[model samples]
Target: MQERNVDIAIIGAGSAGLGAWHAARQHTQSLVLIESGAFGTTCARVGCMPSKLLIAAADVAQQARDAEGFGVKVSGVTVNGPAVMERVKRERDRFVGSVISSMSRIEDEDRILGAAHFEDANTLVVGDHTRIHAKRIVIATGSRPTWPDFLNGAGDRLIINDDIFDWDDLPESVVVFGPGVIGLELGQALHHLGVRVRMFGVGGGIGPLGDPDLRKLADQEFNADFPLDPDANVLRVELEGEQVAVTFHCRDSDTEKTERFDYLLAATGRRPNVDRLELKRTGLALDERSIPRFDRLTMQCRFDDGSLAPIFIAGDANQDLPLLHEASDEGRIAGDNAGRYPDIRAGRRRTPLAVVFSDPQIASAGVSYAELKRRDESLASIAVGEVSFEDQGRASVMRQNRGKLRLYAEHGSGILLGAEMFGPRAEHLGHLLAWAIDQRLTVERLLEMPFYHPVVEEGLRTALRDLNVNLRRGPAITERCLECGPGA
Candidate 1:
């Protein structure tokens, strides 16, 4: 067995671990990154990268299908699911290969291909052969798709997000369980590939914390193409020969129904990949959800001894926001704090900016209206304005007019609290709102800022104008005035 010492040892080579490794690399040459599998876990291999490729293909297919409506004569159009899957796999492999080749540039000793478990506060045993002693250790093990016991028997018949990308042939029909971000994104992609996708979940929208209006818009758009059972709760999964059958109960009807599909995908959710690590050996305790207990601010794992241990956690393992961007940000913070002073201070991080990659993409940041109302009774906010795609000339030109933009600002302080956008080019519109919310920009500043006219972003200008007008009218304006007043 070989023993080595390093400044930082990062477990898992996914987004968060990679972020921590890159951040720590700039400060110290002695950094070790360990992974059970190859680099680029779900995000690169299956979650975001491959899924987006499939979505892009679906977009082309949809455009071709809709071209006839715009007086563009189109010949017979056919969707080749296998070909689409092949292209998706090719692109995914290319990206993953690029990442792996990049990792090769680092010293061989710095990268370990094995599972790692903490031996002590600052020591880790890798693959039962190599021992790594570090001043600080970071756990960026990420997460795995969660499937309930009820679906256990389905076994090989059911696929997870990680398994879907490996398939060479696409299923003619897919029943996706759970309405989380993955479910919606993959569901829409599969549907666009001509798969009859029936998404099961009673949850309102894709992401649990996405803006409600955005959720409604997604439901409206996707429901037109695929069956979105919002209140459907899957109770069991059974393998019937070549097909998988799902039995679910509807919340509204309280009746059970069974649906058969060529493939069953469990997008139920993800749990931190901590089970195999045997964390109990190191005296680290897991919460009820099986996630490690850590200080949310510092990303430091809490210990019984008044002193903090060097074992830190980031990304999905911390069970914070599971978005790749948020995880990487947390990893950078954790890696920096781990190597530096013990009590390094930093401001609290607010709710992260999140987006759902769907046809009509959804984006949201800051406190939600429902959450704010729960916390503060007297809390008041002015909805600056909501401009539909129908109102945007760019959307009209592109014939992608199927979304809206909305901004919310504090009633008194005028600081931007949150924003939501749905429809074509919603993701691009979200970036501006994300910057505004992150900077806590005032409505006055936002209104004064120059935005290109005749663009989708100009919708923000329309929204800000509405907010300015409402500010001029006192606080006593009724909901009717807010909706359809002379100025409105």
Candidate 2:
């Protein structure tokens, strides 16, 4: 058997793993990275890049159809599904290739092209013959889409995000299960591209907006494109001829409605890839969720004696924060801490930012109003400022005013705590709010910043102005950084 030794070993060559590698390589050369699949990360190959490509294509088609609203009647619009898919794959392949090319710059010996299983806290066995003794191990194996037991008989009818982008043509009709991020994004995109799509979610809202008000607004805009059943509780599957039959039952209704579709997309959610690594061999305790316990701040696992073990978990595999940016940050923390083991240090986490890239784009930063209200009983001390695109000048000019923006802050402190919105270019607005919250900026401070005229950002200013009205400590807004004397 072949044996080797490394100071730090990273499992899974996805975004989190790559981030860990990049960070740890700076401190030590005694590092090895292991992968059993394609070199490119999930975001590049399946999750983010390819999905955005398809969404961009669908956006074009949607714009063409909506051109009549602007008093410009354009006709002869035809969507070639195969051609669109071709371009998506061609472009997606280029992205995947770039990721692989960068990784290839590492020496071949440092990259082990196989799955790794833990033999002990400091030992890993790769395949049958190659054994690696790592002083510290960083688990960044990421996650995979999960299928429910109902899909057991779904032979050729099931599709997940991993394979959706590879299709050469669009399905005639599809029933999307779980109206989370993947389901809503793909469902809306497919509907825009002339596919008949029906989306089902367990709750009354789509995506992870976390606020009831924002979810209602998002559902309204999303339903305009396709049939959305956000309250579907039970889904039963059966076969109907060559097609798959699905019965959706809403929580309030006793009736069962069955529909047959050419495709069934299971976007329920994703689970950490922890089981495959044989974590039991590591001698770490597993929680009820079958996940190894690790410190959220330092990303370090503890031994039975409460001492830090030479192990770390990061990215989706940790099941804490699954977003790409969060994974990258966690990976860096894990790698940095792993290399400097026995002297573990916690790094500051980034401000919470999540986005759903559907039309109007649902995004949020920091804590949501719902979360604050759930934990805090003093609702009067919390203030919410809202601005609707229905009346915004820029939105009206472009005929794209079908959403709302909400900003949440403390009533007395005027500290921007969180923001939730469904508005045009909300992704950009969300980032601004995230940075402001991260900096602990006050409402008065944000108002002092410049806001241009006739832009979506003006809507943010409007919301901030409304929020400032409820601040108890000071005036709603002051124009200057410091309360200035009259030209003295």
- Score each candidate by Cα lDDT: 0.76, 0.85
Write candidate 2's Cα lDDT for 1-488 as tens digits.
78999999999899889989998887899999999787899999998999999999999999998899888898857889999999999999999999999997679999998878998989999888789999999999999999778875556788898788889998898888888889988888988899888888776767878777888888777777677878865567776767778877743577778788888889999999988898888788788877889898988887666777889999999899899999999999999988877778997899899999898788889987767888786777788888887877677777878788888888777899999989888889999999999999998899888876667787788788778876676755634212322110
Give me the overall lDDT of model 1: 0.76
lDDT of 2 at 310: 87
Superposed on all Cα atoms, model 1 deviates from the true structure by an RMSD in Å of 3.9
lDDT of 2 at 122: 90
Identify the runs in model 2 with alpha carbons over 4 angstroms from their true place: 233-235, 249-255, 377-380, 478-488
Best by lDDT: 2
Give the range where candidate 2 is weakest over 10 consecutive residues by summed lDDT: 479-488
Please list all clashing residue pairs in model 2, or write none if there are none.
none
